[model samples]
Target: MSTNARLQANPRIDAIEQVCSKELLAQTAPHDTAPPGLSETRSDGPLSSADDVEQYGLSWETRAALEHSHCRLSLESQSGHSAHRTSMDRETSDTDGNTYPEGGLEAWLVVFGSWAGLFAALGLVNTIGTFQTYLETHQLKEYGYRSTGWIFGMYAFLTFFCGVQIGPIFDAKGPRFLVFAGSVLVVVQMITLGFCTQYWHFMLVIGVTGGLGASLIFTPAISAIGHFFNEKRGVATGIAATGGSVGGIIFPLILEKLFPLIGFSWATRVVGLICLILVLLACLLVKSRLPKKPASKENVLPDFRIFREPKFALTTAGIFFIEWGLFVPISYISSYALAHGVSSQFSYQILAVLNAGSFFGRWIPGYVADSLGHYNTLIATVALCLVCNACLWLPAGDSVPVLVVYCIIFGFASGSNISLAPVCISQLCKVENYGRYYATSYTIVSFGTLTGIPIAGEILSQCNGEYWGVVTFATCC
Candidate 1:
């Protein structure tokens, strides 16, 4: 049969072509273009304009191209565009058609920048144990564990809670100013932290200033990656998150050696210098994919309505428990070791060992989550953390070998909780609203961060210096 005969024979195929032409013209026209061939009298009827037929070219060659089965299928797949609309829809869809445009090099660089930024920011979070351990023995020695816990708790609280406001700000302003400002705050905190001799001083410098700096840098650093990749988001995000683990590894080792050599002040200054360099790279390379939204007071504020989604509410609860328990070991493992007669050097190194394992933990699981679902992977990791806390940390007594093992295993397992939670939240919302969702969720979770350490400290105090109470509280909480 002739090609025209085939198209004319199939009424459904003719209807599709007519619909495509009308939709294309409607989209291309400045105002609603009148339906191609309809008068007001038959406006509701199907269009059949000579202009449409002429524009589409009813020539033998054009008909042949449209009639070819392969060509027809290709044309149908690309039905919406008329070779003029170049803007690819990067928006997330309920349908599974969303994809990234610039695949390899560009996406990878964004991931790299995110990793570097996370390393400098989250690295400090992971090493909280080292700071807690050192401070408890030196500057804050007069205060009980419960009293000192407030400082770290506040730090963690600000690190996350501040993101609520910062997320919205990031979406409106882009990351450049936020990241640069954050870098400055972090450098200032590190430089000043060493000079802190009193409890209030530590709270002011590390808890408030340091926490704010971290939140500023961290929200934008991580969020910018979503602008670049969709399919490989898990792997890319994971690769970026490993920076925290790397920082965890490096910071502790540096602190351990530097503490003895130049005293705490100079040691922190050196670390601050390192963070300065890394953060500069992050500021330069890390960027948003979407144009900055116009800023307004309304847009900058977080909307709590997202909790209307049941899955997000449950996920938030899960994260709350995870964060609540997370800081215990980081804040106390060194103190536990020191109290148990382990040398100071080994005690600090324990944090490094955990972070070293975490470096791998961040990357490997991210690769896995790409194939497996992000939430599925996160749930499994959370379960693993519960096991590590229950089995390894619970039984770790005065034995160096046992404590060391616990640190490495728990460090790796918990690393996923830090890195994957944002991705899981991203999965729940549109890519554009990711900053809002992430900010809102963590704002609530920040309360957990604020009090988790102090509560653990109280548990320690209640147990008359025995760590079992603190460990049990950490496990249960």
Candidate 2:
């Protein structure tokens, strides 16, 4: 029977068979030739039957023309064939293009693991202010704010820079080993932090060890979610990122009560206990989606050629400035308040308020970013941060309410800068290479984190105790 006649006699059957055949072809196709618009077709060209074309879901005229063509089926047919081949490609291109792997108990459990891991890693970064405030008064009290700033600055630096090697390592080896090692290092650092009484000790335990632990946990924790969801990525990432905000809030409260009650060492031990629990959960749950790539020299080192893209270059610059400015406020807010005659309790509470706002800040703006455009959302957030510094923080001086308001607003606004930064970086690169891109970008930007607090500290010193110089420097950077 003619193809059209066959299709007409049992249209439903023809459609089902056509779909099945397409799926079969897709399953058998080589990966390199599987992506839509990237495949090569036969020189003999396509099937000539109008009915067959229609069965394939193409218009009659187009199908007939494609069938008659000397060249391979039109670009559209190649695209359609490609879509038919890979379920992932088809799902990704659809209206609700977001798709996840088989969803059920195991998938969600992995997400839970990621959430726990992120909570521990990012949580500490979020709570840096609490650490900074406490250390400035207790452990590192004799050091200038700028000098002590190096401790947290180095922490931030290592948190990001370690990602350079960690990303490639994760891609090659998976999260199992990485998360395990990181957990051990982080727990060790926390346990030792209570014993640290010197500058180099703080740098060794908190800066290097804590930073490495964070990088190990965070990079995989965030990257693993991409293995599970595409359409739901924004929500998943936001949910995972909230761990940081939660940690931020909890740590400050714990420190506030413990500092006066149990003293600094015990307070740190308490925080470490919390971290141990969270990190353990992370180690159990977080996993890499793709099978690990074989270890090779190519996969081991970072590729700097990505800077050839101007948009990426601009993004790196923006993140650098943001990081450069971010830690200054985090490290100095309490000191700034105390120097300006704000009450000690209020000064400490200010950091908590900032973190409280950040909880929503990380989640809401992330959802918005999925809709409004990641770069657009990021640019707006960066501007808000700048305004918070320039308008609210710059003039507050000794005003308690104004400073408190600034803390809340700025905290919320800056929260996205921390959480969404990886999302923004993901937008710029492919999923398989996300870890590498993210790690490389942050490796360069970590320099900004390293220097920012110290520079701000120096500015504070140069001003002979005023924060205006630091504020101005923050705004300018």
Candidate 3:
């Protein structure tokens, strides 16, 4: 038969699948559960699927396993040729393993669009300290640190929390409408932030509105890139994510300088204008290549049943811990510097420095991850976070050099943590289902985002305004 010949259903494929299923079941730990919507499918005969022989390449080991299996399997052709086969199909990609263009002007443009959108969304997330410090001193000076923490924490929570519904929407409708809507909300948040004077005003404008805008922009921004790159997904995602770090570095510096000249009201409007311009570019360029699927019950609504997959469950847990530790530093470094007697001028600069390091951190880990293993890179980078917290930041009070070193090392490591997370999540499911898995994982992780900063704030309060309590909590998480 020709290489292109579509082989029909065969016993070899069926037998190999049965053996693989049995092996998978045998390998599952007692606590591990089957994946949602997948494990429940079965029959007394071969499972229903259109997969062909070539798609299920069988090797010697597969033949050996079949020999031990109960099925009567044979791979010989009519001409007496011996057959070879290996593992069953692992990925359930909707497009059946489509190849990417890798690089082109159009492809690069899409990546750039994604970068710009994430810049507005995650960049603000990275620059939360600048806002937190200013808020404490200005509009909401009477509130305790824990109360302020709740505001930012809610912002962080909505950034991911709303993604549960948005992810499935992206999978069904495409990126254009979502990006457009996000652009409007973000502009509104920025423009309105300048006028807010009360604690509730900040909560409504920055916390809730801004958070929803970010979810609308970023969820679709990240999802659109996957349609264009598969082999180089790590590098592409890393490149796009650098926008957040770049935004982090740039925005704080702008606010630090502009706050005095323009004051809070106009400075935020300036940032809003900047966001508007970039978000326009994002709306124009970021697009999905996959044909849009109609809204289905599974794709339109949030489902929590995906937790049955143990790998996904463990991955989500790892993300929760990473996020739990991640924001404590981002939200408090400026405050920490001020408390340690650092100059006010330089206190604002520290966040910029941290973000500057993260710019480089995001790209390098991604470039190398493709060559190494995705999970391997993630594990190493997360360990870097723990070390930076326990060994470096914990003892570095009032020491300029120590703070600087901590910023560069920890900033870079945490940047890798942000960029690598979705990449690792991509490994746990099919490409088409990537959004579902990513959103679900983040929905669970959002609670960490919701509580982490506030808990850290309470820790700071408990230590009589000392940062060590928060640092220790961050290290342990």
Ranking by TM-score: 1, 3, 2
Output the better candidate (1/2) by lDDT. 1
RMSD of candidate 3 to true structure, Å: 14.9
Cα miss at 368, model 2 (Å)? 1.1
| Candidate 1 residue-wise lDDT, 229-297, digit = tens | 776677778788999989988999999999988899998998899999989888888888776777787
| Cα error, candidate 2, residue 434 (Å) | 0.8
Stronger candidate by TM-score (2 vs 3): 3
lDDT (10s digit) by residue, model 2, range 1-477: 665675456554444444443444445446664545222342444333464345445555644443344323333244365443354443442133434653445666777887777777777877787788778877788988777888888898998888889887877777898898988887888789889999999999989999999988877887777667665566667777888878878788788878889988888888889889988998888887677777888887778899998877888888998899988887788778888898887777777788888888888888888888777887898899899899999999999889989888888888887667878787777777878888888888999999998898888889898889999998887
C-alpha positional error of residue 11 in candidate 1 after TM-score superposition, expressed in Å: 40
Instruction: Please estimate how well model 1 matches the true structure, expressed as its whole-model Cα lDDT.
Output: 0.80
| Deviating ranges (above 4 Å) for candidate 1 | 1-99
Backbone clashes in model 2, listed as residue pairs: 26-85, 98-231, 146-457
lDDT of 3 by residue, 379-415 (tens): 9988998999999999999998999999999999889
lDDT of 3 at 220: 85
RMSD from true fold, candidate 2: 10.2
